[model samples]
Target: MSIPTGDVPIGATVLALAEGATLTPVWANEIGGFTFRAQRADGTTRYIKYGPHNAEVSMFDEAERLSWANQYLRVPVVVQVGADHTHEWLVTEAIDGASAVDPRWIAEPRTAVTAIGRGLRRLHDALPVSECAWLWDPYSRIAGAEARGLTVPDRLRTPPSDDVLVVCHGDACAPNTLLDDAGNPIAHVDFGALGLGDRWSDIAVASMSTEWNYGPGYEDLLIEAYGVEPDRDRLAYYRDLWNAT
Candidate 1:
């Protein structure tokens, strides 16, 4: 996913959702989904995410995850979730921070990486795994991918033993973290895949994302900020699993 540029046509459904609120396109995903910030005249702000039907990403799932996560974390407040014959939309009250991959944070990798680490730890420690109704283990992920008709390597079938399991933020990439002015991570977004799984499922992805967002040499920094010595075995296994599935 990336920040949108140039003209991004607003769909009729999204326009209707805005209800006269001024709309600003904020994000565009690789799968053709778009997230817009809707600023109403009364000073309230809401976000509208719209996309064509895609099994991999579901706005309805995201809305449910956000609702469940909000009981323990700072997630967007759901306003509405609906889908048309060919598309889906989710409207949520805007959160109060910028994404970690925001240009300002991109220029300050040290702070961004550190915050991402701490924030991830907080997420793991805060969300109750036993209460979670979703699963993101390798078996589930592999099965889901296969159901989508994607080929999976046999090597990925036997994943490493579970290290500590936590409610993982399935897409723990840099862009999913939100940070405040002090560079402290305050919230996380994109929870369509959030579920019970090994903590490394998130750790490996979050650390690996550092290279894509802020270059190399910062992987360990994020791991360090999470307050644990790197488990190379688990890290490698999950990173590979992420790429394959």
Candidate 2:
């Protein structure tokens, strides 16, 4: 996923959803979904995410997860959720902060990466595993990949033992964490796959994303910020699993 650049077409459905609010495209995902920031004349703000029907991503699932996580974490408040035969959409009340991968933060990798680490740790600590009803475990992920008709390597079928169970962000990449102007993480977004899983599942993905966004050598720093020693075996396994699925 990446921030949209240049002109992005505004669909009629999205236009109706905006209800005359000024809309600006903010995020474009690989699967063709677009997230827009909608600001009204009265100064209220909301985020609208719209996309075609895809089994791999579900706005309804995200809305549910966001509502559940909001009680324990700083996440967007779900305002509306709907789907038809061809498309699905979710509307959420705007929250304060910019994505860690925003251009402003991109220029400051240290701050962005550090905030992502701390933010991820906070998410894992805050969301209770016992209360969560979703699953992002290895078996589920592998099954999801197979359902998508992707081949998984035999080696990936066996995963490392769990270190600790927590409610994972599912997509813990840098872009998902939002940071305040002070370079501290205030909230996280994009919870379509949020569920209970091993903490390393998120740690591996978050640290690995640093390389994709900010470049190398910052992995250990993020791990340190998460207050954990590097578990080479778990990290390697999860990273490989992520690639496979």
Q: Per-residue lDDT tens digits of candidate 2, residues 116-189?
A: 99999999999999999999999999999999999999998988889999999998999999999999999999
The alpha-carbon lDDT assigned to residue 76 of candidate 1 equals: 92
**Alpha-carbon deviation at 18 in model 2, angstroms:** 0.6
Clashes (candidate 1): 0
Misplaced by over 4 Å in model 2 are none
In the range 1-245, model 1's lDDT, one tens digit per residue, is: 88899999998899999999999999998888899999999999999999998877588999999999999999999999999899999999988899999899999999999999999999999999989999999999999988888899998899888889999999999999999999999999889999999999999999999999999999999999998999999899899988887
How big is the positional error of residue 121 in model 2, measured in Å on the Cα after superposition? Answer: 0.7
Candidate with maximal lDDT: 1
